[model samples]
Target: MALPAPPKANRRAWPALLTLTDDLLEDIFLRVPTPTDLARACVACATFRRIITDRSFLRRFRAVHPPPLLGFVPCWRPGFLPAQPPYPSAPLGLAVADAADFSYSFVREGKWKNSPWIPCDVRQGRVLLKCCRNHGNLLTSPSDVELVVCDPIFRRFVELPPIPDDLVDNRRFDLGHLLAPTAGGEDEVETSFKVICTAANHTTLVAVVYSSVTGHWCTAASRSWTSLSTAVPLPCPGGSSIFDYSQGYFFWMSIWRSSSLMFDPIRMEFSIVQNVPKHSPKFPVVAVGTEGIPEMFILSDDSFHLLHFDIAKGNEPSINEWQLRGTIPLPRNCMFYTTLGAAEGFLFLHAIPSLKDPPDYCLLDTKTCELKKVCGNHQKRFNRVNAFFGFPRSLVK
Candidate 1:
């Protein structure tokens, strides 16, 4: 009792978390391992909520932590397959899935009540969807449909203004992507985005981009398919619903030709990446390399090959050449079916054991080269699934 009475001054000097400045609090919160944990901390007190909700703090946090892959959203149906136990991010993913609206009910309100919206692409917590009559094929042309960009976690959406008639009159919409913001401060990155839609006619391939900053659509690039490249035949954009983004560029494996189409968003240019591997039946999925270069993953019967494209030195201008990096053997008895999607250093694939057996879905960690089965024999329930990945930073707000 005498000793306790002597230490009253020391007890009174102890620091309180609430007394810390916003700057110091943010410094501590940035170390949160996952967005789900951060979301939980947000409700601890009013000060924690205010500091985490700040736009500046959110941007800094994202920079420190890469977005977590929640789950795959089936393109064929309005449902989500949450990552379950055994998956590293399963717990965080399940929380996000429970909180977000994959049904897209927010877009069905008011005048668009009866309209059907199909998920086109998902990037950075935002879903890109197009309103169309047909929902059977994910690769159908979206030339005449209205586009909507929504944050499903927050249940807010913005209906983009129609692309000008002159820009898309006779062209067929091939592929559309929700681009990550490249410039501006945190507010712009959080609120502003661009949608790049590619369309083609008999003679020309045109790219029209709609910017949220401008609230208008403009032609980004237009070139005759013949002039773009000679090594590959005309591209069939409707052939596959698979595309990948890396290093400020978007890539689509040409189904009709032995090449891939590359789009540079910064320069608004289209070029051909020739001499890519011609793996039939299944196309290689592109993932960003550790050094910022692009790498492709090709799946075969027994193993999957990793290929990297590097510059070939010569008198000629720099051209990307695909080089075999390594190969990872698949589990015995598993046969490759088709590539479902790729994101966040993981590739999703469909596999079947035998002709009579049901298909199994697997996820490949590109870095660790570890393959794990996610779901099995549900092909009848969901025809095709595209993985939708992001950190739910906006969930707090």
Candidate 2:
């Protein structure tokens, strides 16, 4: 029996793998932070690549891992419509920057080859771009606008169906996207997304939804928009929409009413989140999360202050009271600024320089209260801040 103890290789194999079970291997693979890193790991061996590419494994990875701060997409465009043939062509492109370390790059793809695409909203790691090619003259003819949902990280896009004739002719529509998790544990990067176009159909609000599951568009009927007029008097024509990931609500800020238009994608219902904390009229911005999804900070009194819209506590049906959390100060005289975006307890603020100083971008950590300069004149010239947040990484072919 002792002489048949077996080869040395066989004895070491069992002990070596005792601590590295299938579950442990999957956990180690999920901890890879970026998609680029994940891709690199796949090349190590065929077995690892197969596990990473598995549909179930991808779902579990995304569920367990929190998104990391990638960079900001700065858009530079004069208007939503392309200039006439005789006019000079406009400059439109997306600038990608490492807001943490100040590294930067630009995404120049065929989608924006000729005309600039207006970035309307960012959510679920995708940006909604409105193609400005067919939009007719603002005064004379109806605009034939087309919407596109883009994954800037992957440099890919999916064009949505054209808007209805009436909705385009009337010129009253807003776009938003929801990248929900699929029930079947499909690849997150390939499928499981919905685009909603809210248009003012005469006196009512009609939403056209496009689902990746069906590969087609459908209309959602709701009476919630009937009373939306009281909260948002005029629909935001080609404006940005923000979604609350944890609470599952889309928010549209109403400049006229100084309130927020909240839409529940599940119920197809609309409600108003009113009593937002007053902010600077010059550069009003809302950073949706400080510690989590419930706490939000708005730039007020030339500083970033925390507030919460407690929807569950209020007795009123329409408005929820905003509770103050804390205040975050800025560099002296750096008052005029806009909040580009937020994620993982960080706020991206774009400071507008006065005549004496230069423009700057900064990253603020809400937890540690540390402020760091991400970009300045040395990195790149940014005219506008389109999106600044954590971009998710997924393996989708």
Candidate 3:
């Protein structure tokens, strides 16, 4: 006779079959890499989300990858270009601030024909690329968008669609992009990037955003004429470009006065954030730093305390407030970092032990104030280089 059934009053092992607690299953899920994969694991248990938390993992993954990078070589060189303020050329800048602290400045490179490249801090782990002035004829338009998206660390690049010429004023070129996930994703999919630009001409200012998911550009809110009166007009608005994918917005320093006046790259907004410089949001330059987390240094030259702009609320005069934070002032010699994205708990920087030549690549730890060298073949190092360092490799999804 066949053996009696194991269930239905005689024997029961159903509880043991599903004995694994939700927390236990969740812990197992976190180990898997990839958003799509993690998502599937999350579906297995409500406990998985609590443990692995899809968006949380993806975000941390984005921050750690630390995107800003430069992988550009112009088709043709420019005749001549200007530097400083209206910085018509390279935006080669070195940042001493992290997401938390917000004071930044663009370092002017000495060489003009070096094909300078600047690292854009958008989408956290992925870099939005920019190159110095190229041949006018080769360039699509005077205000043409000349940025590309590529892996900062790997040197991989992708040229993006040019910005509409009519929208850009050509008087000033201010660009920023925010990386955010779109609604649709099945199994494996490319993450979406939201590119935002604010180009202000003599009397025209337009805000535009590009959706990587839809593969097309869309108009953001219009420029407010109310603030336009007081809004520092071009000619010398030294706004530093920044892209925050986490908050679904891009930011820039619209005007650089005593304190750097900042603007939002997305939603076409502006604000004043004085949270940096010798006080709160103060950043000291450190070496051997990671990309996402940057060590900041308040320079003696710039204002003792610098203010960052925050325009999160959409419409309103950028509040004038400088929250106090600690400051770091390092010897000019030690304050070397790559002008790129922050990641891996440090700021990627370029430093030259001797000022006679270009600086060597180094990493500065933001949290611990540690410096470590990361450049190899220092002699053949990348020229006009910007960085997007520290992001972990596993979290690209």
Candidate 4:
């Protein structure tokens, strides 16, 4: 079965696979399935890396291809507790799941992983976890806290400098609100974002600003929490909050007070939003609404649009209020829960089944009306579900 061997010159002659135009290379790279794949491809060869890492190439890639769903981080309750040594504490770490199948991977390889840091808020793709460093006493004054901003998908984290001594010892103030990725474009993972800290005293809302671009933490300005009275839900800054990035505002919920705090990052101003009506409907209020109906934020026509839906016994799911839009019919038996929240065009219902059965975290697409079960039997572990929403994978600095 032996055959004549080919010439050595012929065997050595092979064309390079990367000998293509930049446009062609970009087209190939854009087709990569996920961000992880893109990252891996960038490391394969110098030419490929250079082409993929170019600013224009990355921008075009994002425009042509949709962002990936990085995963969900289970933000545990009893957040930002005082430091106690002997008592048992809940493990503070994110339960990261895959976008496609909702599979999970570890953050920082799950090292020690016993810290008490809990997530305050997740914006753009960044999770802000904070914990008190040292507490002389919890009754009289607050403790010095450290905030760690992390990109769970990237597994990169940075700890901001400690709070100033005077701010820590002040009896009237508390780090009630924290928001991250303070700067840079929303599409890019830039390290230039700012961490805006809102401290609530008796009557005034003091803001402490942290600039990653300048590497400095200074008190930006102060404003009065003057217009409204405190509500029964105990309106802490980021405790029950949602960010409207299009409007550059963060709406903080006041459960019984019937008002929400509207914070502006650019102007550093605080205004009262009175349109959030008092509703004892069978459902829970999720996010801000448009034209007097509760709805989620939507981006369209170079401006922000509101997407609202009604879940009732028999009526088809339709957005009728505020210059009526199209209707999306839901599948049968899908409107079981009366309370829900919407993010990224999906509805997350508040369901806690009977003790004999496990709880369910169900997601329904507002556009498609397709229902899927996510995070099966997670209720047995944590006390309460703090943050659950769709987190699209982006380059959040």
Candidate 5:
């Protein structure tokens, strides 16, 4: 019968990835190496998008592969420096820089049209900014300002309710930090977030937290600076006073005082960690150590010193102690500038080789001890640049 039509090819013999079950697909996706690849995989089809966008899947993916550092957003400027050539996440970072609104045009709606919004913090693909007059004094107590949290990728924002009058009175807002939803044990993404704004009076240091879930501002913690240490003067608000969030606590370091203020969001308490090496550089950055403890990286004259802080226990009462873990010598001809920030085990440093040469933005891998330049000779100067370290995702609730 016509040679049996040459025996029709069997479609079943070919691989059918689309036919895979949801569980099997998620298992396969978990093995995806980076969030950039994961984001690309999301566009393959509707099925892939559905599975990847699920909150449960995202939580699992983050646990396995932490989000990548996409770029650096200048604190005062309106642009960003994306990860460029040779980096594994270069493509994704470039895509974000091209598509996202770093200028934050969306906040210009209504009464905020002319108000300038300064980025206070960036975490989990969201930017936390404060909207106020150009002449506003951020260090003053009980000021009139609006806090806006936005996802530039999705071009969406929520104006956080103002801090309660009682909480704001006599308090100077000094620092702000953004906390992810999972940080509070919630699985949902983008539907909610928490903002911690720290303020201080001459006598008391106070933290006021605004929760999107509840739509209210509440004082999370407050402690007298004198109680922590009389020698440590009130942390003067400045660009050099850096803060990092690690192990569910917010640590604020005062470079001049050689002390750090630690805030526990859950317990609503503040503790003091004293005796940071006085001789280290002014812009030392903090990151989580391999053992889950907080560590500090100090860029000295010729080497980068790693110090691990731990609670020393005995009959002498518990105290925070810093131990020298290791050091990495700086490459020849390179000189320390200032630390930009730290994220995902990498400390971002801005270094100048010579007084005549252009500066470079470099990344130092805390675990592997690998150092490389990510961006070179950025044209626009910035007093502070915060590392934005997460991939854009669906904002659907």
Candidate 6:
């Protein structure tokens, strides 16, 4: 009798078939994507409902993926940071504003080149930054002559003290960031981290961290601030950028043209990550994320194909076991805007192209595999989606 057809009833068997109780079974099912799945599992019985909502099960969701290689993707806009006169007496950095304000600039196509106030050279524009959790507020950096902290979202920013005139003139370049405490509350939002690289002096270094608690930039007994030179350029968003905090250290990159320097906050060192090995004759890319892991890639068929990587582990020198992973290919003549917060299971993409009927945007997806677009509409593009931004906190908890 064909071995009794291998027990046909086992497909839907609930209690007896599996060792787990109805409650436990539903808990496993909660991890499923849709609410419909949760609803169905709940209806399986009261036992199912109890397990599905169990706080413990949800907590596991906090880490949706293997601890992500934390990284930052610049919140890219269409045009460029507004630049000033052909007559400005001093050198300037990039445009800085809250995320909301940046979006308005982002929405206005060609404004980058079109805006007269915006510098003709985008590389000299302000480097903007947003909170990993709070994506609306922007951290602004205009130029070495003056520093302003304005919340484009609330229209309120604290004016930062300008660097000394002598210092500004002496320094060839500058970089900055707004950093919050590693272990703190949702409300802690004041301290700022700034760095000015004196390229003219052949010295690369960080400036200072102005602490709201003490109302001054934290200074060491040596009467100087800390330095974060990871041999990698601690990219100040807007260019080839990647700045993340992992293993109690700040990881970043500062890209020149074909090369970059990796900076790790803990070691306070700068290391050259030569694209010669990671890049191709085609396109070159690199990133530092989730505990300062370095991921190098190349463009092939409009996608950034990962070549190899090693995340922030402990000492003994972390290494990226280089290997081709996947790619995020552009649909048209577009490119990735930025990559931010590797949370649950996906990586976020801030992408746009001049030719897009509407415009490109930051779309979240995954690092290991290509993802289908969540909402394809410009109106709803920024809303955080599931499979992107790694895994959802809701699912984890």
- CA-lDDT, candidates in order: 0.69, 0.53, 0.40, 0.48, 0.70, 0.35
Which 10 residues in a row give candidate 1 its minimum summed lDDT? 310-319
Error of 4 at 308 (Å): 6.0
Q: lDDT per residue, candidate 2, 1-397, as tens digits?
A: 3566665664444444355666787988888876667889989998888889887887677667644443455542312111122211111111232111111112233243454565655555566666554332232111344566666556567767765564444545443444433333453345557777655434555566778657776666444445654533543333434433334555555334366666666667666665655654533334445444545566775677777555442233355566677787777756477666554456667676764566676677776777766655423445444433445333244
**Model 3 poorest ten-residue lDDT run:** 73-82
* Top candidate when judged by TM-score against the true structure: 5
Per residue, candidate 4 scores C-alpha lDDT tens digits across 1-397 of 8898876674675776776888898999988876668989999999999999987687677656544332234443322111121211111112233222111122232222443566656565667666543322222222345666666555567667765755434544453445643333446354556777766555666667777656777777666555444332343332323333222355454333444455567767665544443233322234423333335433222222333433232222332243324433433433233223344445544344545555555455444555555444544433223333223244342
lDDT of 1 by residue, 1-397 (tens): 4554454445466665576788888989999887878999999999999999887787788778877666777763566777777777677678877898988888755334455676777777677777654334444454556777777778888888877778876335455544443443654645677888886656777888998777889998998878866443443433224567665667776344467777777778777777777654567777765455678878776777788875222212235555788887877766445677677667787777777777777788777777787656554545456666675324122
lDDT of 4 at 270: 61
lDDT of 6 by residue, 40-153 (tens): 767887777777665555434332323221112223332222212231210121222122253333322222342311110011012222212212123222222232333233
RMSD of each: 5.5, 9.1, 12.4, 11.5, 5.5, 13.5
Cα RMSD of predicted structure 2:
9.1
Pick out the ten consecutive residues of candidate 6 with the lowest summed lDDT: 116-125
Ordered from best to worst lDDT, the candidate numbers read: 5, 1, 2, 4, 3, 6
- Which of the two candidates, 3 or 6, achieves a greater TM-score against the reference? 3
For residues 1-397, what per-residue lDDT tens digits would candidate 3 score against the true structure? Answer: 9998776575645554656775556445545554456667667766665666655544444434333222221112111111122211113222211121111112223123444444444333355545545422222222443555554333345555666655554554453333333322344344555666555544445567776556666666455434444434443212333322212332232233233333444345544333334432323322222232112333333222212233334555344454433443334664333333333344444565564565555544555655555433234434233332223232235
TM-score of 2: 0.69
List candidate 6 stretches off by more than 4 Å: 1-145, 148-154, 164-169, 175-181, 185-200, 203-207, 218-259, 266-268, 274-278, 281-294, 311-321, 325-359, 362-364, 372-397
lDDT of 6 at 32: 68
lDDT of 6 at 245: 35
